[model samples]
Target: MAVITKYVVERSGVEKMTFTSKAEADAYDKMLDTADALQVLLSASNQLTDEAQAEALALYLAQQKEPLLVALGVKKAAKAGKQDSEEQTTAKQDDTSSKGLKAVAAGHAA
Candidate 1:
């Protein structure tokens, strides 16, 4: 008799499917890891119930049509852009304030 090794996938506490190959199983497991990471990131907490974490993971997996890794790159770019914009705004405000201070000092000197 030939022994077969299979991987089981469970969803919501129920058995969902099985994979015949280790690579396939590893891929699914990695997806779950990504979901868990995302949940922690979005909630800023690691104390979520199993159901809540699973829900978040499922939602993330479903929302992405492409690979999840690609979305992370896009998110990083967007965050960097936002930071740059905020820095520009703060610099402008500082410049305006310094100019106002200079004008006040000149008036007092007159």
Candidate 2:
């Protein structure tokens, strides 16, 4: 039998995802953590209709964090040394542009 290796991301003892590459698994896990933190922040807002809406908004914020950061003045431009080169920035935006909130939360590139 051949050997197979996989990186699994688990939450609360339950496997949430499996990836062929460790990087992919790690990234997905990080995204989840971000969403959870955002959820807590949203909770303090007291404006969310319910937990479901809070969770959705949190995930969307996590998935679109890069642009959101820039728009919020939290991330500086490449010329200011906070980002990569212009071409790399363009490519990253292009890759994420097609993905919806769910696709990005799943660590997928559309």
Best by TM-score: 2
Question: Per-residue alpha-carbon lDDT of model 1 for 70-108, expressed as tens digits?
Answer: 565644455677899999999999999999999999999
lDDT against the true structure, per candidate, is 0.72, 0.86
Best by lDDT: 2
Clashes of each: 0, 0
Measured against the true structure, the TM-scores of the candidates, in listed sequence, are 0.40, 0.65
Model 1 segments beyond 4 Å from truth?
A: 9-17, 45-54, 57-59, 62-110
Give model 2's TM-score versus the native structure.
0.65
- In candidate 2, what residue range of length 10 has the lowest lDDT sum? 77-86
Per-residue lDDT tens digits for candidate 2, residues 72-97, read 99887546563457668888787777
